[model samples]
Structures are given as structure tokens and as C-alpha cells.
Target chain A: MKLLQQTILEKGTVLPNGVLKVNTFLNHQIDTGLMIEIGKEFAERFTDSNINKVITIESSGIAPSFFAAHTLDVPLIFARKKKSLTLKDNVYTSQVFSFTKQETSEITVAKEFLAENDRVLIIDDFLANGQAAQGLIDVVKQAGASVAGIGIVIEKTFQPGRQILEDKGYRVESLARVQSLQDGQITFLQEQISVTN
Target chain B: MKLLQQTILEKGTVLPNGVLKVNTFLNHQIDTGLMIEIGKEFAERFTDSNINKVITIESSGIAPSFFAAHTLDVPLIFARKKKSLTLKDNVYTSQVFSFTKQETSEITVAKEFLAENDRVLIIDDFLANGQAAQGLIDVVKQAGASVAGIGIVIEKTFQPGRQILEDKGYRVESLARVQSLQDGQITFLQEQISVTN
Candidate 1:
């Protein structure tokens, strides 16, 4: 978590409309070594949970999800933004509004991939408005899968995303929570939770 | 490579139009252990090349790219599918036509991540028409980076992807090249080159 926080401080950029650009290392381009460390951190945090699979959305969430899945020795499933021709007709889907893209898109996962017996963990790069995470949770519910927990790389704690998930009674863990990014200066929440009870 | 070929034969479903869906292990739902093996294989394949960075597109390519980067001890740079508010104005962009989606979209990489001095290896999930690889190659070229090679997990040799890259004089090494996928039977090319070589 410290490595991720340090990377964000060293490389993340702040833009207008509460957008944090981590393209240099987090999302667009990735530091694989650091990613493995981050994934190990998530696995350590959520090791006690009953997470059988790691779920994420397309584009940004793949790397961390891979790392976490590898660490936990579980399968990684991602909901695709654009449902390709290869997808089956029987799918659990939810429409999500992207504040960044300003467009509504459907995210889907095959019904066969998720089942009532499965425990799922949602993972993502950024947690801003929580719309994307909500969509993934909705898909899991549709498949009758249990929501074990949610893992995020960088979270805008100032936003309502944390509160929304907490309101739903889902345990959320983020590596680096940004307290404020006012005046182009980034701030972090220094509270660290011990993985063990 | 045997493991990958076996996965394709077992989980991969053949669609109507030469499309083989291996989302269960390769793309949508990933098998982490297999991916790690794939990463190790890629590392061994490109060990002799002076690859400074591993470049790929977002979403599907991120998992293998991360593993490959980790194994090879290089930075992984992925091209984002869209322009976000946080990305800088300076970018290397290219258009890729998705055969599965039947549409063309632009993929962009931040200019700073790639440089003239970098030697890149482009990695991807599938190489059908080679549009996605071409897009990534274009971005690398825009950055004046030398492309050491192109690595594909599964290449449909029946398609034009291999020919196109070969025409470009790019060293392409596909772990599993499908010679045919007729009547739900998957066939692999001669293992002499990839296996014995």
C-alpha cells in the first residue's frame, strides 16, 4: 500500500473535474513490479474473506485484478463495456453512467461464469462516483453471487463512493485514499488498518 | 504452450465466423496460473531481445502484458481506448478495427511513457486481422521506439494476421497458432519451430 501511495504521489496528475491521471504508471501504462506488490496487498487484506473470484470492468482494472487473482490463486472475471459477438445470450448485465465519458454503457458477464455458490470481489483502478463498482455489484447480484468485498487502487475519499458502498454493507479496502486534491496538491488518508484482527 | 493449447481446445468455443472464444481462461475470465505460465513463456521467447518495455492495449492485453513485464523485468505500457480528462494533450494515437465489434476505435498512449530510445514488444490476446497490433505498433513508431517483436497468445494463422506482420518484417512468435477450427476441432501449427527451436 505504501508503494502504491508513493507511486501515486510521484506520478499521478490532477486535472479539472476531480480527475486523477495515473496514466504514467497506474492505468494506461503500468509498473508490473509495483502492480504485483499492490495485488499482494489486496490479497493480504481480503484473505480472510470468502472470495472465489475477482470481478472488474474492462480497460483499466485488468492488471491489478490479474495480480490479485494470481496472489489469491483464483479466477479473474471482467465485465466488458462492449458486449462482443462471442458473448452468450444468457448474461447478467447492468447499465452504468460514466461521468468521465458522459455516456451510459452496459456492462455484462455471462451467467455461466457466476453462480449462486460463488463469492466475488470487485476490483478497479479508480473509485470516483462509484457508478462502475455499483454496476459490477449489480451484475453479481443478478447471478446470485455473494459480494465478498471490494478492492481499489486509488480512491477519492472526498467523493461519496466510500459512503455509498458502506451504505450497502460491502467491506471496501483501498490502497491509497485521497483526502483532497485542492489547488493541484494531493493529500492522503494516513490511517492504516492492520490485516489481522 | 501445451497448457495454452489444451485450454483453447477444452474451453474455447467456436463461433459462426472463424471466431474462437477463449474468454474462460484467456480474456474475460482469466486463469491466473495459466497466465503466469504464459508470462514465463513470453519471457523465455523474448529473452534475447533488448526489450525496454512491454506495450499493449488496455482491457484484455493488460493481464498477459503484466505477467510478461514482470517476468522480463520491464515496464508495461498500455494504450488507453479513449481520451480522458486527466490524460495530457500530447499523445500517440492510432485507429484499430475490432472484428468482433465490427467497428473501429482509436487507441492512445501518453507520449511520455514511450521514447525514441525504448525497445518495445507488443503483446495481445488474439491476433486475427492484426488491427490491434498494428495500432499499438503505430503508437510505438510515433514515439520513435523500436519494436523488438510482437507476441500473441493465440494467433489464427488461417487469418491474415501472421502474413501482415511478417510482411512488416516484425518478428512474431505466437504460442499457439490455430491452423484450423472447423467442426469444433482445433488444430495447431507445426510445433517444431516454437517447441524445438
Candidate 2:
């Protein structure tokens, strides 16, 4: 967690209008070593959750989630944004609105992958408004499965995503919680008290 | 390699129209233990290539490529299919035609991540007609980087992907060289000689 928070401060770019660009290390150009550490952290955090599966949205969430699933010795499933030819029918679908792209896309998981008895751990790179995480949770619910926990790499605490999921009684664990990204400066939740003091 | 080939035979599904679905392990629902093996195999195969970076397309390609980059102790960069708000300008872009979706999408890699002196290894989930692979290669070339090699999880040997890449002089190492998916039987290239004899 220290490494992640440090890397975020060192390499992350704070864009206008509450956008944090971590593409240099977290999403686009990935730091595998950091991801391994992140995976270990998530696995350790949810060690007692009895998570049987790790689910995430495609594109960005696969790396950290895959490593977490690897460390936990579980299968990692990514919900697809678009229905491919191979992924036809028998799917649990949910709609996710992306504030970054300003679009809503259907995210789906094959029904064959999730079951009623499975305990799912949802992971993602960024938790802005929690639309993506909610979508994944919806898909898991459609299969009659239970969500054990939510693992987020970087969370925007100023956003309502964490509160929304917590209100629904999901245990949300985020590696780096950004309290504010104002004036091209990033303030983590933990650092907030000290900064204000 | 044996593990990957065995996985393909045991879990892979053959659908109509040259679609070999291994979503059970390779892409959708990922087996991380197997991916570790794949990373090790790819690292061993390209041990002498001096690869400084591992690159791939996003979504399906992230998992295997992440492990490969981890094993090789290099950074992994996934080209984005769509430009998000955070990823604006200063990018190297290429058009990729997806046979599965029957659509063309522009894949972009941030210019800062790639360098002119970088030696890259391109990894992908599947190499069917080599369109995706070609698109990745084009992006790397745009960065003025050299592709050290190409690693694929599965290769449709019956297709022209391998031949097209080989003709272009890129060293392609596919764990499972699928000879044919005819009659719903998954055949590897190594098994072809014996199957014919």
C-alpha cells in the first residue's frame, strides 16, 4: 500500500475536473512489480472472506485483479464491454455508465462461469462513481452468487462510489484513497487529517 | 507449453466459423496458475531477446501479457481501444480489424511510455489472421521501437497468422499451435505429423 501510494504521488498526473491520470503506471503502461504487490495486498486483506472468484471489468481492471486472483488461487473473470462472437448468449448482463467516456455500455459475464454458491471478489483500477463496480455486483447477483468484498486499486474518496457500496453492506478495500485532486494536487484520505491540522 | 496445450484440448470449445473459444481459461475466466506457466515459458523462449518492454492490446491480452512482463522483469503496456478523457493527445495509434467482432478499432499507446531505444515483446491472447498483432507492431514501429518477438497463447495454424508474421521476420512463439478446429477436435501443430503418419 505504501508503494502504491508513493508511486501514485510520484508518477500520477492530476488532470482537471477530478481526473487522475495513472496511466503511466497503473492502467495503460502497467508496472507488473507494483501489480504483484497490489495483488498480495488484496489477497491479504480478503484472506478470510472465502472468495472463490475474482471479477472485474475489462481493459484496466484485468492486471491487478488477475494478480489478486493468482495470489488467492482463484479464477479471474472479466466482464466484457461488448458481446463478442464467441461470447454469445447465456450471459448475465448489466449496464455501466462511464463518466470518463460519457457513455453507457453493457457489461456481461457468461452464466457458465458464475454459480449460486460462489463467493465473488470484485476488483477494479479506479473507483470514481462506482458505476462499474455496481455493474459487476449486478452481474454477480444475477447468477445468484454473493459478493464477498470489493478491492479497488485507486479510489476517489470525494466521489460517492465507496459510500454507495458501503450503504449496500459491501466491504470495500482500496489501496490508495484519494481524498482530493484539487488544483493539480493529490491528497490521500489518510494524509488529509495531517494536512488540515 | 504442455500445460497450455493440454488446457486448450481439455477446456477449449470449437464453435462454427473458425472460432476456438478458450474463454474458460485463457481469456474470460482466467486460470492464473496456468498463466504463470505461460509467463515462464515465454520468458524462457525470449531469454535472449533483451526485451525491455512487453506490449499488448487491452482487455483479453492483459492477463497473459502481465505475467510475461512480470517474469521478464519489464513494464507491460496495453494499447487502448478507445481514447478516454485522461488519455488525450501525444499517442501512437494504429487501426486493428477484429475478425471476431467484424469491426475496426483504433488502438493507441501513449508516446511517453515507449521510447525509440526500447526493445518490445508483443503478447496477445490469440493470433488468428494476425490483424491485431500487425496493429500492435505498427504502434511499436511508430514509437521507433523494435519488436524483439511476439508471444501468443494460441495460434490458429490453419489460418495465415503465423505465416504472415513469420514472413515479416518476427519470432512468434505460440504455446498452443492449433493446427485445425475441424470436427470440433483441437489439434496442435506438433500432433499434426503424428496424426498424418
Candidate 3:
């Protein structure tokens, strides 16, 4: 978690959209060593959860979740945001609204892939408002599966996502929690912000 | 590679669109163990290429390439198919025509990720017509990075993808090369086909 925090401090940039961009090493262009360590952290945090599978949304979450799943020795399933031509099977779909895009899109997982008996751990790049995680939860519910916990690499705690998931009784663990990214300076939840008296 | 071939034999299905579907383990719902093995296999196969980074296109390519990058101890960069609101910098863009969409889409990678001194290994979920790989190659070219080789989990060799890439002087390696998927039976290149006999 400290390493992730340091990586954020070094490589992350605060965008005008009130978001933290970790494009340099988190998602777009990945730091493999950091990801592997992140995976180990996730596994350690959720070791008692009896997680049978890891689930995530496509594009950004795949890489990190893949490593986590590998470390846990479980399968990983990513919900597809857009259905492609080759994906013609019956799928469990849920609508997820993107605050960034300002539109809702249907996210899906093949109905047959997720079994009812499996316990899943949901992993993602960042948990902001938790819409994406909620969408994945909806899909898992449709398949009669149980979500053991939620593992996030970064959590924007200023948003209501963690509270929302916690209210629903899902065990949530995030390696790095951003308290604020205001005025081009990033702040984490557990770290003290310098207050000039 | 043998495990990949076995996975295809046991779980892969041939869709009516003449595509071999490995949605059960390869793409949609990933078998994390299989993927890790696939990663090691790719690393073993391309060990001598001196690949400093693994490059891929977003969505499906993320999982496999992530493992391969981890195994190779290199960074992984995935070219985003469309630019997002957060992506507002100088990027290396390439237009790729999608046969499914019947239109061209722009694929981009941030300029800073791919460096001129790097030797990249391009990894993809499937290689059918090489449009995706070509788009990535174009981005690497923009960065002045040299492509060591292209690694594919599966290749529909009947398509022009491998031919197109090979003609461009890129060494391509596929774990499972699908020769044909006629009559709902997936066939690989090594197995003697009755038609050829």
C-alpha cells in the first residue's frame, strides 16, 4: 500500500475532472512489478474471504485483476462494457452509468461462466462513485453467485463509493485511498495533511 | 502451447461466423491458471527477443499481455481504441479499419510510454486480419520503438493476419493456430486434415 501511495505521488497526475490519472504506471502503461505486488497485497487483504474467482470490468481493470487472480489461483472474469460481434451468447447484463462519459452503458458477463456456488472478489483500477462495481455486483447476483469482497488498487474516498459498498455489507479493501486531489495536490485518507496554523 | 491446444479441444466451440470461440477460458471468463501458463509459454518462446516491453490493444488483450509482461519482467502498454476525456496530451494515433464495424477507429498510446530505445513484444488475444496488431505497430513506430515480435494466444491462420504481419517482416508466434473451424470442429495446423489427405 505504501509503495502504491508512493507510485501515485510520483507518477499520478490530478486532472481537472477531479480525477487522479495513473496512466503512467497503473493502467494504460503498466508497471509489472508494482502490479504483482498489488496482487499480493489484495490476496493478503482478502485471504480469509474464501474467494473462488476474481471479477472486474474490461479495459483498465483486467491487468491488475489478472495478476490478483493468478496469485489467488482462481479464475478471473471481466464484464464487457460493449458487446462485440463475436460475443453472441446469452449474457447477464447490468446498466452502469459513467460519471466521466455522462451516459449509461450495458455491461455483461456470459451467463454460463459465473456459477452460483462460486465466491467472487471484485477488483478494479479505481473505486470512485462505485457505479462500475455496483454493475458487476448486479451481474454476479443474476448468476446467483456470492461476492466475498471488493479489492481496489486505488479508492477515491471523497466519493461515496466505499460507504455505499460498506452499507451493502461487502468487505472492501483498497491499497491507496485518495482523500482529495484539490489544487493539484493529492491527499490520502490515512496520511496527515499539513495544516499551517 | 500443448495445454492451450488441449484447452481448445475440450472447451472451444466453433461459432456459425466461422470463428473458434474460447470464451470459456481464454477471453470472456479467463482461466487464470491457463493464462499464467500461457504467459510463461510466451516468455519462453520469445526469451531471446530482448523485449523490454509488452504492447497490446485494449479490452481483450489486457489479461494475457499482463501475465506475459510479468513473466518477462517488463512494462505493458495497451493502445486504447478511443481516446477518453482524461487523455489530453500528445499521442501516437493510428486508424484501424474494423471489418465488424465497417468503419475506421482511432487507436492511440500516450507518447511517453513507448520509448525509442525499447524493443516491444506485441501481444493480442486473437490474430485474424492483423488490423489491431498493425495499429499497435504503427503506434510503436511513432514512438520510434522497435518491435521484437508479435505473440498471439490464438491465430486464425486462414485469415490474412499472420501473412500480413509476416510480410511486414515481423516474427509472429501463436500458441494455438486455428487452421479451420468448419462443420463446428476446430482444427489446428499440426493435425493432418482429411481434406488435405
Alpha carbon lDDT at A136, candidate 1:
96
The most accurate candidate by TM-score is: 2
DockQ score of each predicted structure, in the order shown: 0.80, 0.84, 0.68
Tens digits of per-residue lDDT, candidate 1, A47-98, equal: 9997899999987888877778888888999899877788868888899998
Q: Would candidate 3 be rated incorrect, acceptable, medium or high by CAPRI criteria?
A: medium
RMSD of each: 2.4, 3.2, 4.3
lDDT of 2: 0.90
DockQ value for model 3: 0.68
**Residues A54-148, model 2: lDDT tens digits:** 99989788888877998899999999998888887889999999998899999989999999999999999999899999999999999999999
Clashes of 2: 0
Write down the TM-score for model 2.
0.95
Q: Residue A153 CA error for candidate 3 (Å)?
A: 1.1
True contacts kept of each: 0.94, 0.96, 0.84
The residue-level lDDT of candidate 2 at B14 comes to 86
TM-score of 3: 0.93
